[model samples]
Target: MTRSELLNDLEQSLTRLVDGMLVDKGRSIEFLTRLDRLDDIAIDMARGINADARLAGFFADNTPWLLDEDLTTAQKGRAGTLFAEITDLLAARTDEEGLKLGREAEEWSRAMGGRPLRLVLRATREEASLSDRFHALLRREAEEVNMLLAEREHLMTCLDDVLSSAELKRDRMHHHLAASLIYFLKMEGYKVEPYVRRLRRITEILEKEKPC
Candidate 1:
């Protein structure tokens, strides 16, 4: 495909992924909760900006300054002008209304702590975490897949023998096999939690929506 076509295809895939995620009620609720948190954060930021009277920007009521300690009088005056502009924008609304929104936002922030936008976006958009060591470890383990498979086969054989032996009880053998399976999967760089989660979700849905 052409470069533009390839980019379009990737965008389509991402759109489908997002759509599927939103289709689930739980996931949609989770997204809405995040948005609410973002709103609260934005409001808190606006309050801070109004209170500081320095470090002006386009959206003067959105975010705060980097260095609050060393703002010049001139900078503060500039910030005052920006605040005046913001006040003009909110002129139709009473100060009481603005204060109410601020109080509500503060309460909401208390209810659900602060999260910077960058961190939130990183959490939602990224697949792999930003840990080089984790990526390296995953890569190393993946490279040893064949060796891990061999080790797993050996363990399975031993587990079979243990289960069949007269001296071993069924429960003991099952426990040993479970431990071995866990170890083997870890060694092979396979994440079993997602599969377990899928099974649990299926079981929960089935139980809740079973035929009456």
Candidate 2:
């Protein structure tokens, strides 16, 4: 594959894997394994790009930044790459398989600009506390949702102690984007009661976990 083509494939794979994590717990292992396979040296040499090194940079970045309209075309690609890199690093931990989850995430990001949904609070990108706060508040809530899903899925898969710190961080990001997206729609007065209910269930689940 050409360099650009390889990059495109990488993006799609990363996007898919990340997307899978957000929506489908059953398939997460498959996505992660794909990510690990793509980490191979032969693939990089064939494409003339060091996939491992390129993906390493992704681990240090945040997923929401990928959606910032202010990012240059190049910057968006970099952010996407970083997002994928992080996914790859994370997926390496378990039943091991991994890509293709990005389109839905992008759609939600566009929802910020009133795409398919009105905005009560439009999310804008700037280097400021307000920008950070918008995502931060929703992200914390999102993390709760992720924890619930992760726990339930772990029970279903019977996978134990498979998560690393890096894995948890990646998991948080996926939940944030998904939760923040729903919260954004809620801000618009959209019909997000289902999401709100699903999110609130996290609290009840946690309550059950506390020492009695």
Candidate 3:
């Protein structure tokens, strides 16, 4: 074959390979986007749970001491308003609505004699619950991502085997890309580990003792 003809054939082959890679990348991106949306919803649910947990804990912690005092009608009104504000925020899905409610709750809590120490303790309890729920979802997602990674790896491995049998050089490029994708998922899974461990520890302690 003439040199020009050989070059032309090679160019066509590379073009087709690039097109296939683009298609695969598009599929991967779409799948990951869906995963991202699921993650966002899980986070929002966990946040709502955290908000409600905080309000409940605040009342539990302070109602004892506050009830001992002869609270004014205005003080009682503000406390009820704070509780309602927190409840509203817990029910809110939109960030704007939640933020507005959060601000109102903060103001009401302050006006109703919320102490910083009590607030901190209540916040910790809320955060613990949020972490617990988030970790549960995270573990499930991790397993899903791991399964996806394994599937992709298996497919890529098969592709590599086929390409090797056919003596195709392009398979090397695909194998490289597949490995990179797997590494990215592993990195993300690693990022979620600490929270999972925290949740596990909390669960262990809770199981060991009964709530009074």
Candidate 4:
């Protein structure tokens, strides 16, 4: 395939990847919110009970009406199922395992910041470098990507702080983390569009040039 055709294909693939990531991110936020809400309800229900048995007995004695009161019928059903799944997950995981998973998630979010554009540029570096204007444009795009990466890193750090804090309630922590992720994605996604446009421009210029 021609260089322009290759870049166009790559851009389309990356766009699809970005869309998928956004959808996954939305679902992840929803999952975390549900878990946090359940945790809050469990904590409330466990009041005056022994600390160790609280989580274990959360859904044991009787299903709490609190969930029904607070959630829609569909949400209540989903929450019940999710609670069971979370119980199984907690049973299977040690504190260390849980911490490791949290760290992995944070690392994955950090790594995702500028990866799509970086991969595209790396794949087409030779053709992009052929024209000084295109090369300079790529540099500018890289700088913009870095700026977005820095912003996302800062937001992610704020999210980590919220997650790590003992003072914040589960509900507050969930809101903060969800807002931070959505904001980070919004700002980061904005950067991708411009970079994609610049890439298309570079490809168009390359297409117009005769082979040496």
Candidate 5:
């Protein structure tokens, strides 16, 4: 079944189970709050998956240009190293790592001057002095690297938020299902197993989409 259909089924089943319970009003409120939290986490997880897919596509498309053989060996090596470092930093999703990588990338870009850099620098040659052209190339590359670093940082933040939310929901769900209410529902002949099963399936899907 589609995700929306599964979510609807789960919500309806939970609603029915909650309605049949003889719990106090406070307990009912807690159950509903947990349900809402789970739903929000699921939705955010899906959004994060979609965002990661787009970022992967972006990297795939742009990476080859940086690896082009026309660029100098040093330029290509730096580009490859930066890509690797950025990927690792993004996976870790720490601001400190990102800032360190950003500084390294900026320094590398400034020192890098090859065919691609020369081409761009030559374009504005008429408008710039020799020293200005040199600085211009450095600035251009620095700006590009900074933009990429910012994008990676933003994507990593989104990924970290989704992962944390998913973990929180998982713990909450475990606690909620282990409560006496779940036992009461099962004793009443309610089919609550399917809800848990569906949730597991959704978690598996998210796992497959997770970044390496």
Candidate 6:
């Protein structure tokens, strides 16, 4: 594969690994503990890249500063750009919308003097987090995957408690957060989920979501 192809493959592999880590936190820790496997894969990829004579020749022929022993401005720019690309890929943040929000937030921060502007931006971010993470679950899994009917009912009751609370419903972001929290509980299987508090603390944090 070409260098771009190799990098794209690595990015896809990393993104899938991150998704697996998010979905299975318990096993993810075990996977993380076995860092040697990751090291081996990275080393193998590096060796494969090094073995690509044409890939090296392409870089040598195109890059004027390739043979420079001293780090030039071009080298610094390339390094910074590559680092940013890797960061964006790993974070799954390819959209310009988040950057647009940030630029707007910066302008508002200058106008409003920091704290107040931050509250508004926080609200915006929380609102933007409305993507339903549990939407992709198979219908049969939700019905029959290692969960009893009673446990499912228990989860439903918990969700009801969140929705039924006047306190949670007072603020839209809090309401959304409560729904998300419950969705996660259900997704993780109701039998193994933790107890829900009155959510007073979360609401208190949600206090910041109220832009002055």
Higher-lDDT candidate of 2 and 3: 3
Candidate 3 least-lDDT 10 residues = 165-174
Q: List TM-scores for all candidates, in order.
A: 0.18, 0.25, 0.31, 0.29, 0.19, 0.17
- Which digits, one per residue and each the tens of the lDDT, describe model 6 over residues 83-134? 2222222233345643443343233223322211011223455463322212
The residue-by-residue lDDT of candidate 3 on 1-212, one tens digit each, is 89999999999999999999997677555444433332333334434444434344444455453453444343344343333334333444457645654554565546655322122124577796566444433433334334344435643343333233223222222233333434554565534343334334444544555346
- What lDDT score goes with residue 140 in model 5? 33
Query: What C-alpha lDDT do the candidate models reach, one value each?
Result: 0.38, 0.39, 0.43, 0.42, 0.42, 0.38
Residue 156, model 3, lDDT:
37
Q: Name the lDDT value of residue 152 in candidate 4.
A: 48
Q: Write the per-residue lDDT of candidate 4 for residues 109-132, one digit (tens) a residue.
A: 233221211223444666643453
Instruction: Report lDDT (Cα) of residue 22, candidate 1.
Output: 62
In angstroms, the error of model 3 at 1 is: 3.0
lDDT of 5 by residue, 1-212 (tens): 99999999999999988876634445434433432332333234323432334334434454444334444343344343333333322343456644554354344334433122222344455655455434533543343233334334543332333334444554332233323233555677765574445445547755676669
lDDT score, candidate 2, position 61: 42
lDDT string, candidate 2, 13-109, tens digits: 9999998777655434433433333333222422345354434333334234334454433323322332333333333334322222223223323
> Model 3, residue 59: displacement in angstroms?
38
- Candidate 4 matches the true fold with a TM-score of 0.29
Order of candidates by lDDT, top first?
3, 5, 4, 2, 1, 6
The number of clashing residue pairs in each candidate reads: 0, 17, 0, 0, 0, 0
Ten-residue stretch with the least lDDT total in model 5:
111-120
**Best-matching candidate per TM-score:** 3
Stretches of candidate 2 off by over 4 Å are 1-80, 83-170, 203-212
Instruction: State model 1's lDDT.
Output: 0.38
